[model samples]
Target: MRILIAPDKFKGTLTARQAGEAMAAGVREVFPDAAIEIVPVADGGEGTLEAALATGGEERTETVQGPLGEGVEARWVLTGKTAVIETAEASGLRYVRPRVQSALSAHSYGSGQLIKAALDAGAQEIICGVGGSAMTDAGSGALRALGLRVMNNDGARARLGGAALSTALRIDDSGLDPRLKDVQIRIAADVTNPLYGPDGAAQVFGAQKGADAAARSILDDGLRHWAELLHKTNGTDVQIPGAGAAGGFPASFLAFTTATLESGFDLVAELVQLEKALDGVDLLITGEGSMDEQSRFGKAPLAAADRANARRIGTVLAVGRSTLNLEDVTGHGVKALAAAVDCAPSVDEAIAEADRYLQQATVVALRNLDEG
Candidate 1:
């Protein structure tokens, strides 16, 4: 049997490549003679850069600002003139765990620095993955790094993070990098939240980033204020779907440049040539940390399953846990399922030993399919 294993990261536990390796081990246990190929994938989040580099690229690393003004080593992929930058590499939420008060001060300046580095490297196209952000500055910090100065009521540079945007007065882009006009910027994001409102950035993702009720209110207002400033500066007021992703990161690009928002899964899949990888595969195994109703839409696992199904291939989805039942999973063209939570003693144990539980679950899933 020819089996293809492709999975996304299991959050803080296992990366996509690690999950693929575990699934491969389980496949070997079941069918030692099976031809197994492991291809890790991502939906333009933390693992986007890795997925882009999987096929081969010039990996570049540089010291940039972290979520809280600290220096961090951020990595990106430069393939020819196209560059892949994952926001999580610089302003990732991982760096600000238990976010608390710092969430209000976190900035995306590092992401801008990454873009500048790409420009300096002669990139003609830049694909930025926006997710897992630690700030809700509506991409102000990033724009600032690109020479867009955000001024406060006092005509001075505004403080970093979401809160300070409430008092932000205006912006000046005269000093913005000239090369940005020549580059094609694609913002890769999955969420459909607008820039600021009830279902917007601050109200939805702010709490997770350590914003309380009052803080969320402040952040939401700040985004609104920032939106007005952007409109006054660039004559563009964008509030499109997916603009709220990564703390309204796309809003900045949409306002200042000709950047367009694209589906995260689609962008990365193209970069990794996922469709070609699935050709002639007998069984396609794909999954993420959690599989739920939301996963049925544009998530990478479902996208991968769709590709396999187009080729009349069966699919087995292995995940840390899933809210979808057999019927729901089957409706999505997935033939079988393997959940680490089912194999491990507890949810904590499942995450603590994700690799071990994932392998065991994959083995059981294949055995069950055989019995059926």
Candidate 2:
């Protein structure tokens, strides 16, 4: 039987491609002659660029500022004149140390630098993958790097950071680089948060960026102010769903550029032709770091399962962790839910032993495939 192996990255452990390879190895151990296909997936979050670049793209590197006010190096993928920038490369939370969680001081200037570099490289279009960001500056820093003037009432230019958002009095779009007007920007975000509200950028994602209760409130208010200014200056609304992704970066892109917001998974899936690969496949195996209620809403595993189900193919999920009620996943077309920690010493230990455990788990899971 033909089986499709598709899974998202296991977070701190293996990448999606590695997880697929490991699972494929296990599947082969059980059914030596089984036809298996590996498809790595991402939800427009971390590893998005890697997944996209896998389908053939030119790689380029640039030195840009990290989350904190520090010099760092990052990379982007370019396909012809279309460049893909993963926000995590410049403003990811992973850059923050436990002792230095300064959400206020982080910036997206490096992301802007990457975009600028792409433009300088003669790119006519840019695809920004917005995920795993550490700043909530409403993309002000990015705009700043593009030569937009974010100034205070006294006309002094504001520094590149989110903490200055609350103090900004004016945004000068006339000073924006002329090159930006000719470039098309597309934001690939996995979330659907609006610019401001309970489900808005700061309220929903700020805490993860190391914002405390006070910082959360401050960031929320700052985003609100920025959004209002954006609306006033651009004469267009900035609070559309998904506009709050990547710490309100999408809102800024919407306000400043002719950027279209799209689902990262859907875009990548179409690029990879996952649906075509799923056709005629006897069984589809998909997974992620964890499976839960959130998985139903455009996540990578769910996206794969949805396509497989459309073809009436059986789908099984093998996850590093499982939090969804069995009924929840079963009803969503997952024939079986397998976890790597079936008999591990502890959850932590299980995660540490994920690769080995997944191998053993897959053997048993596939052995029962024919029975079902």
Residues 15-38, candidate 2: write the lDDT tens digits: 888888878878889788999988
Whole-model Cα lDDT of every candidate shown, in order:
0.88, 0.81
Report residue 103 deviation for candidate 1 (angstroms).
2.1
Candidate that scores best on TM-score: 1
Candidate 1 per-residue lDDT, tens place, 101-124, comes to 777888899999999999999999
Q: What global local distance difference test value does model 1 have?
A: 0.88
**TM-score for all predictions?**
0.96, 0.94
- Those runs of model 2 whose alpha carbons end farther than 4 Å from true positions after fitting are 98-101
- Pairs in clash, predicted candidate 1: none
